[model samples]
Target chain A: MSTADIAGKARAPWMALDKLGVLIALIAVAGTVLPFAVFRANRIVLGEGLQIPFALEALPALVLGVLIALGIAIALMALSPLVKLVGGFVLLGALMILIGLAATGLIPPGDSFARVSPGAGFWVLVFAFALMVTDALARLRLGPWQRITILALVGAALGSLLWAGTFDDLSILKEYANRAPAFWAEARTHLVLAFGSVAIAIVAGVPLGIVLYRIRPLRAAVLNVLNIVQTIPSIALFGLLIAPLAWVAANVPGASAIGISGIGLAPAMVALFAYSLLPIVSNTLVGLVNVPETANDAARGMGMTDRQRLMGVELPLAFPVVLTGIRIVLVQNIGLATIAALIGGGGFGVFVFQGIGQTAMDLVLLGAVPTVALAFAAAVVLDALVEMASTRERAR
Target chain B: MRAGLLIRLVVFALLVAFLVNPEAFAFVFAPLASNGQPVIYNQGSLLDLTLNHLMIVLIATTLATLVAVGLAILVTRPFGAEFLPLSRSLANVGQTFPPVAVLALAVPMLGFGTAPTLVALFLYGLLPIFENTLTGLTGLRGPVTEAARGMGMTGLQRLTRVELPLALPVILAGVRLSTVISLATATIGSTVAARTLGEVIIAGLLSGNTAFVLQGGLIVGVLAVLIYDGLSAIERTLSRRIGQRARA
Candidate 1:
């Protein structure tokens, strides 16, 4: 045999034991041994863990048998790319359905007080399978557009599952049911606080950045001020804003009339806006500075005004970096908005703090999940925009 | 340079003065308080709270640096290269997930206390360290590494003697960022019953005492700035030693 062929044969088994294989093994072991769900006697009480077999007791024996078989197949065999991808989806789907079934099955008839929450095992299994699917997708080396399409598909699937009430039995959903109205209201406030701040930052910061770039001397002083502002903690900034804003609202003419105040949306918005300026202004400066000299010279030769050159040439070329700043601000503002609730600003953090106060983890999840999802969504959308902008510039 | 040194000394003196007797600053905050309200946060000693907060941040940042730098080293190596995507995703994942949300989520699993706060801070801090270390290790000039290889240096020796030293400044920058972020995050940990500076802020917010709010906010803000300044100085020194330009 050829040396290469001999080496390939010798390395076959070890090659099969790749990262995905190790992950799948972890999934199987964790899924089987750890608690799949917790059976809480009621809200506000600690729950008892139910292992996989007990958690899935309500499911048909055949379903459990299939789950075990699937786990073994994915773990023992070197899965084909297509099989791994499909297997991950199937496993996740099966787990979701089975968990719901288990919750429903575990609840005694007419006992509405009891709750069934997904335990550590359930999360671990979900995380592992999700990682496996992600790994499979990476192996396939799909384009950005393809990856985003898959993200949309996965999002839609999850949405449909939620819409279909697949997890209605889950305590998180139960908490959601209790304050559906408040949830939507808080969600709106969260978005407004996050996006409004970013919108303002972009409008003001870009122009300021351009001025800074033009003036040269003002750049360092202005940026140093912003840097100091950025170094301050979000909560502290929010807290500091209260006294001055309260004073302004009380003493300044027409301040209170325009919704300016120590607490609520005004202070939160201002604090977030202040926090946002550094990234936007600095990135805008960086982007404009990096715009090709050739483009600027061409514009000048074409008799374009300074404004025209900046608007038509520099900004467009620099659009991706500017968008990146907005993305950072948006994601950051979303997270910070949760803390805004502490000062009566009204956002998802209202739920978070309330959940903490009440010792209701599901309520905390209600706040946290959406905050994360919003940040993730903002990041993905902005990332896509940045990519499209950069590619367009490259093409030009 | 003299002015900068003077400013640093003043900041250090102020931090020491505040810790030694926070009530001494009560006059500064008194005007912001409503009638008859105490102007200083008195539930916990400001020094104790500040120390505890710093302790939490130190622990979390150290742990995050170790794990994240190790992961970066692993994924950059030939044998562990397949895990690069996973590590990249992890670093990306850290930024998208807010520290507050992570902290809240951790409460459900680990329950209320320092443990959950540590987990949250550690998770949140990982990205900067990992990303910077990866960049530092990989961004070395080809000739530099080639010369090391040509000198009959083993992989471990080359890594220790050449790669890590060159990468130290960048890696330190990452640790600085992580430490500052963990400082902010650890403040939020107070909501989860962790003894942090946020306790004073929360107390102020809860009681609607502007002075108390100012005290907490002032201390945390000053602490963050001092720590940031201290780290920047170290980063600059390291960068200068390595003949690389220091990044602010």
Candidate 2:
């Protein structure tokens, strides 16, 4: 066969089957077959819950039109690469809007105590949309910076929507509404725990790292200890800290005055600090050791003292790597800080455990979504900072 | 170093003995009490808890390694090159999302049991192995592969005999990291009703008993250290072998 004939044969089948065809089909099947929401009387009780199944025939005219548009977008995915990409995003956005509309419409404002939350069908649709977006972004072949920019823009748009009370009618938002003050307070406490631990880690870790680097004999022992410390589960570490801290609070004259306690910020901060140290310490040692020997010699030739050389030459060279470690520690601490709640340290984990206890999924999501967002945002921002620092170093 | 290893071995033996018969050490914990009563974490056998913890971690890490290595192999091939970014981001999502959140999200679909914990552990363990496998595979020397090809070896043979052997050290490093991480993370499985060492810690938290917490933490911490050392030794041996092979 000629090359043209072969190309046609190859392209035809792929063209007929879009990249996101399977996800769209899954969403379609789930939306048709499953309940969209469950109606419950009040948040905590699950008795006599009514399932509100999804039916295209039952949807309002506007929602039906949107669904039709989404279907068209899915159909258009097989046409061309550009069309497929745009169609994928359109399908995603349309599906989100449909979910919002359906949620608001199905749950009347008059019935305040009767809660309507998302069901399995809603989750499947969300998953399908996420898959569609991921596939589209991959096909787009955007650079990392460009992709991050798009992500930030989308995030900003979503934040604005949320700020504008767009999703206030949702059950999750209702949960948030009930505990608005506590949510903000817990968020503040979470930030304090994460940043406070990171700060302590830097203070302790950097000096320790320098000492380890300067004293070769100490490196292995120190790293081994830190590695072992790191391998202890966060919960366990928090647990381990409680007795010692409580003892200090009771025995030490001024300890309780400074917020030292068995179950609260003190042990939580200590655990987080311990967890953050390994990354910072290892990255510092690695960064310093990897700095070119020639640079140090040149600094020495320039009549620089050891301290001066370290501050001016070595640290600048190693800054990006050290920052990378800090970035890792920061993101890690954000996630770990959630565990502070389990210890009565008062972060987002409060919502999570409380939700589990009460069997309220919305409460769990309230705690979880923000924690994930914070971690993701921290990573993205720090990655950008590291990139910027490295690029500047390369330029120099 | 020998003495250290010997001490570690003894500690491990003692801990195992204590776990198998925690009541034997009840006197040690008797000094610590909460609510005017001596604290005893006797809800389950510590031996069973430790075993279950190990099993969950092993299963999760094994599945993670398989999937991660498979993805790495796929994306290293010419046809799957386009999926590199997609796969990387997917793995990043696995790490960026906390294990607790994963457990929380999973419990609804999988129900509260080993299944959700396994899913959480598997996801949490993915990124380290994925990144390491990618680095190991992509960092393979083109000259070595070319030499293997020149020897009239097929692509599969070259990969199996040359590439994988050379990449084994790095892959082992990845596995070591994943295993260590999963070991620590598996403790959280108790929250989802999975039998794990975390149960002791959780019970201690609820009952205001520091002794139970210490007991659980000590076992998990020591287990982590031992396993970490074991894996590091294996990695060191593999690297030495690879080094010797390269010199030859």
Candidate 3:
């Protein structure tokens, strides 16, 4: 045989071993040897709960099948590339099966008041499997659209499982059972509080930004004031608003009629709006100022009025940057809105504060999961919109 | 500039006076005080509370800076480059999850008080420092690094004597941002039974004592501004030094 053929034959054996796959296997081994789960009663107090030790021998046939699949996957990593891909799929499938079993099967059917929460070891396994899947996908070099599609499909599958009563016995779900009706109301309040403040901030901040940009003297003063406003803690800002708003509600004609009060939604909205102003204003100014001189000249040469040039040229060019500012403000407000519950403003924060007072981890998760999910979703959507806008502009 | 500095100093002095003797500032908050209610937050010593608040912020910010900067350094290295996405997502998770939620979640594992508060603050403070550290390290001048290499400096030497010194200003900006944020957020730790200025504010809200709320807010706000200004000055000084060195 020729030298090339001989080299290819020699290299084939070493190519089978996937280094990251080995790491994943090691983590899985650690996970299997540690405490796999915690057994808790009700949603609140964790009193004298039993720690379920993980045992390979004690696992049912289905779980054992999953563990064996993981082992086989590690072995396949050193084999053919196609086999490596199969191993990845097998690991992902096993993960899903594990989650399903933990959520539904691990706890007995009659233990409605109890929860079988995944412990540190289980979490480590989940993390390792996720990392392995990500590594495999990265190796595949999938396009962004394909990656997102796969992620969405996986998310939908998990969501369906949760919706189909598979995880109804989870402690977090039990907390939801108690507040099922009010949950929708609080979610609505949260959306309103977040979006309403963003709208107000944009309305006031954009014009102020334009004015500041046009007037050199006002820029520093306005920006510095806004900077200081941003530095105030959300809680402190809410506190600061109480007196002035209370005064306005008491003294101003029709203020209380318009819902301007010391506590609850009004002050919360005001604080969020104030907190949102700096980023939007600064971004607006920056975007407007950065519009090319050539663009302005081109608009002027076309016989456009100053206002027309601004509307048609400057604003359009600046739109993406301003959108970025809005994205930051929107995501920020979602997280900040959780603090409003502390002031008796109805939102997820209500659940959070209630959970803390009651010392109920499940209730806290009930509030927290949605809040984080909403923030992440808002950020992703806004980022996608910004990307679309910029790409469209570039295409033009 | 001198006049501005004078104004800041006066403002800081007044803040310290207020913190030292909150009753002295009672008249300023008198209008917000309700009938039959005390005009000042007297249940806790304002000085002690302010110190405790600052201590919590200091500890949290320092820990966050060390961990975030260390992680950023690791991820920027060629060996750790593949973990960048993982580290980034972890930081994003911290940012997306509200500090209140962190406190609530942490309390179960860590129990009530300073430990949970510290955990929440550390997580909340991570993003700014990590982003800044990454930016600072990655944004180092190519020529400067090449010069260091040409002089036969080893990787560690180049990093310590060249890259880090040059990147100090940017990294300090992150530290400043994290510190200011922690200072403000530490107030919320009181809600979880952590000793903080927020305790006064929460108590005020519950009792309709606007004066107490104002007092707590005013102290926290002033402290934040002072810390921000102080850090900005240091950042400016560091940048100026770097500029002078470049010229040399």
Question: Judged by TM-score, which candidate is best?
Answer: 1
What local lDDT does model 2 show for residue B202? 90
Select the stronger candidate by DockQ from 1 and 2.
1
What would the per-residue lDDT of candidate 2 be over residues A1-396, giving only the tens digit for each residue?
Answer: 899788877785536555346545656566544665665677766623223324212554356446635654564346544565565556556555555555576665688876667667656655655655565665666654876787698788778868876677677889999999999999999999999999989999988888888999999889978888888878888998998999999999999999999999999999999999999999999899989999999999999999999899988998899999999999999998988888899999889877766778889899999999999888877877888788888898
How do the residues A1-396 of candidate 1 rate in per-residue lDDT, one tens digit apiece?
A: 899788867875525556656756777677667888899999989899988778766445358547756765674566676677788888888888778877878888888899998888888877877777766766776665876787788789889989988888888899999999999999899889998998999999999999998999999889978988898898899999999999999999999999998988998999999989999999999999999899899999999999999899998988899888888888888888898998899999998889998988888888988888888777777777788788888998
Pick out the ten consecutive residues of candidate 1 chain A with the lowest summed lDDT: A56-65
How much lDDT does candidate 3 score?
0.80
- Clashes per candidate, residues 3 or more apart or on different chains: 0, 0, 2
Q: What's the lDDT for residue A384 in model 1?
A: 72
Rank the models by DockQ, top first: 1, 3, 2
A306-326: candidate 3 lDDT, tens digit per residue? 889878998899888899999
lDDT of 1 at A285: 94
Q: What is candidate 3's TM-score against the reference?
A: 0.90
lDDT of 1 at A68: 51
Please write out the lDDT profile of model 2 over residues B48-87, one tens digit for every residue: 8888899999999999999988889888877677567667
Q: Tell me how much of the true interface, by contacts, candidate 2 captures.
A: 0.52
What fraction of the reference interface contacts is present in each model, in order? 0.65, 0.52, 0.62
The residue-by-residue lDDT of candidate 3 on B139-210, one tens digit each, is 887898999999999988987898888888888888988998788678989988999999999989889888
Candidate 3: give the clashing pairs.
A16-A78, A17-A78
